[model samples]
Structures are given as C-alpha cells and as structure tokens.
Target: QEHGVSGMFTAPTAIRLLMGYGTEPAKPFDLHTLTRVFSAGEVLNPAAWEWMQKQLFHDRVPVVDHMWQTETGGPVFANPYGVSLLPIKPGGAGIPLPGIYAEIRTPEGAALPQGEKGIVVLTRPFPGLTPTIWADPAYIPHRLNGQSLNYQPPP
Candidate 1:
C-alpha cells in the first residue's frame, strides 16, 4: 500500500469488520508488498480467514492465526511463518513454539487426548513467560484459585 508495509498483525474482529465492506475498497491500492498476516486476541473464525485469504489478499500471503496472553508475554501457539510456513488450518492456532511445552489437561492435571476439551496448561516454563505481575506478586495464583475453569475447542 502507501507505506509499502510488509507485514501486519491484527485481531480477528478487525478482519471481520473489513470483510463486511467487501473487496472493492481495497482494489485501488497495491498490496503486493504485504507478505503475511498475523491474527491474535480472539479466535480467527474460518469464515474470516477464508475471506481474507481468498477475497482480500487473493491468496498471495499467508494468513496465520496465533494465540497468547498478556501473562504469557509472547505467542504460545503460532504458525512459524518466518521459520517454516506450515499448512494453514483454518480457525486453528498453530503448534506450540519451540521450548514451550503445552498440553490440554483436566483440572486435575491429566493430559487430555486430542479432540477432547480441556484446559490448556503449560507443563514447563519458557523465558518469555511472565513470572510475576509487576507489584502484584500474589494476583495470578489468587485469581486462578478462585476461578471455576473450563476449556473449549482450540481456535
């Protein structure tokens, strides 16, 4: 486009909103400089992924979906497009990044088999994981203890 932006990171809701405008609005700009797109914050629904891949970017760039949290400090699951571009599985957050061990487990901490709903647990820590919240050392443990946790299918 105007700035010759090569990469973009965005939220799924933003993509969905753009989808509502259709493709015509973007026809006037050249998006060739764009190489890839990254989405996080919420589930990147398959419909939005498809529209961005097929209608917006014309399949020229990879649309990657990833997952992380403020507490995690970085992406836990992501398609490592910079390393090896994996096949896009619509609506899925890609595999755990290297050195980050993650599993879907029950509240009791037993690992759950694939396709079973369970809470995502990090079996080991990574450098990027936040060990403590600034000035709130006890917040994480307290909040976790009080919550009745559940899990849904992976985005």
Candidate 2:
C-alpha cells in the first residue's frame, strides 16, 4: 500500500498472507491501489479465490491465473487483458495466448479431444523461447522424440 504498486504476479500463498494481514489488528490497509493480480506457481484454491474476489477487493480488481514454464519465458495461457477482457474462470486457466499452437497430446503423439488431460505441447514456434537451455540440444531428450518437441521460430 505504501509503494503504490498497481500490479503484481505472485503465488497464492503470498496473496493469501497479504490479505490476511491487511484485515488483522483493527485497521485494514487500503489495497485499492492494486489494479491487477496474477496468480501462478501454485493452484489458487477455490476458497482463497472467492475470498479475494468477494471479501477483499469487492470485485474491483481482477485476479488472474496463468500457466507457463521457465522454458516459455512468459504465460502460455492467460486472460488477455489488453486485447480482450474474457470471463474469469474460478479454477480454470485462461485460453492460450494468440498465435500459440497449443495442444494436448498423448504419449503416442496423438492429439487428445477437448476436456481430456494430456501433456501440453506447442506445435508451432513463438518468440521468447530459447533454442537451447544448455550448450547442446542433447540435454533435452524429449525434443528428439515425437511426444515432445521444441519450437524454434523461423529466421
């Protein structure tokens, strides 16, 4: 509240702690300065999400959850804030980022139908992903197999 931070992306644990502390000890600090809150790393429990939306911010701010990895460098699935304000799903991650060819594939490399859970794979290349995490591509065995592959954007 003191720093006037308008946005943040953090784990559910930290968000919960801050919310809990803000209400304790008689006076609640004003958190209206925060505009957007993004949660990742751990699941945002239903109870916490409800409390944050209903009790904490009074539905003024948006609490978003996205899924990504260090290899991807940014959110692969997230609510597009600037492009469009999509409906916020309580426990579901938002849609895939534009231009990303995301699919759920089985071990045999077959694409799974919607609502089925499988290994998430990128069938197309996007910027931000590094060509190699280590000195050699040999370090990534999954890249050699059909089950998984790395996306290298065309030069």
Candidate 3:
C-alpha cells in the first residue's frame, strides 16, 4: 500500500474525498517520510488545513498552495519551500512569494490591489516562465492583455 509519493499535490476536493474514504491522521503513517503537501486546483478550506496543521504537519512540514492560470502562462504565484508558513486563512490565497508581482484585474484592464477579487494577473513573469507564447516574442503585449475590475475610481 506504500506508494512512492512523498509529495502529494492535489485539490481540496480530493483531500476531502480521501477524508470521506477514512484516511486518518498520521502519527501512524511515517510523517518523517512525508516531507511536503501541496494543495491546488481549488481553494484549501480551513477545516482541511487545520487537519494538516494539527494532525498532518504538526512538525511544520512544508505545504504549498499554488495560484496559477494558463492565460498568464505557468504558475505566476506560488508558495516556495524553505520559508516558514503562517497561519492559513479559511479561504485566502496566502500572500504571494517574494520578488513577484501579482494583482487582480477587472474587465477594462484596471488593476486591483490585494484582498480584492478580480482576474488574477501578474505584472512581471517568473522563473520557469516563457517570455512569449508559441515562439512569438512580439505577441506578448496582446497575450498579457490587462483589464479593469476592482481598482476603479469611485463613480
């Protein structure tokens, strides 16, 4: 029953499914062998995180919540390893990693600041990112088309 999966990157929905199937805490499982737990493809709910924090990662093992999209290319935002994790919010996308710029955008290409809900957009590209799409360097401006949503002036 031991799979070679020290790293499990899955959605909260799938984690819930595992819990539904009766996957219990791991003071029993080799927590030492398990180094990291990554959640993505959906928001990580508070209850699920609490299970990991209390039951799963009591040793403070790493957990990364990747925020990404295909439009801006690969994951423009992510929780890098090695940094200490903070108390996770119930439904918050934990703050972006260092040296990266990301913002939510609206329909008309205006940028929205932190805590605002708009189209998540990256101001600059990140490591392992393709500068342009499909071998077209000049095609980037159109590709990274901005929008206006939350960061609008009072009207």
lDDT of each: 0.84, 0.74, 0.60
The numbered model that scores best in TM-score is 1
**Model 3 spans with C-alpha error above 4 angstroms:** 1-6, 22-28, 70-73, 83-87, 97-100, 125-155
lDDT tens readout by residue for model 3, 25-86: 44466646567787876677777766665555674666566666555454444555556656
Decide which is better by lDDT, 1 or 3.
1
> Lowest summed-lDDT stretch of 10 residues in model 2?
146-155
Q: Tell me how far the alpha carbon of residue 85 in candidate 3 is from the true structure, in angstroms, after superposition.
A: 4.6
91-130 in candidate 2: lDDT tens per residue? 7778988646789999889999999989989876654475
Model 3 scores a C-alpha lDDT of 0.60
TM-score attained by model 2: 0.73
Clashes of each: 0, 0, 8
Please provide, for model 1 over 41-105, each residue's C-alpha lDDT reduced to its tens digit, 9 standing for 90 to 100. Answer: 98899999999999898899999999998888889899988889999999999998875778999
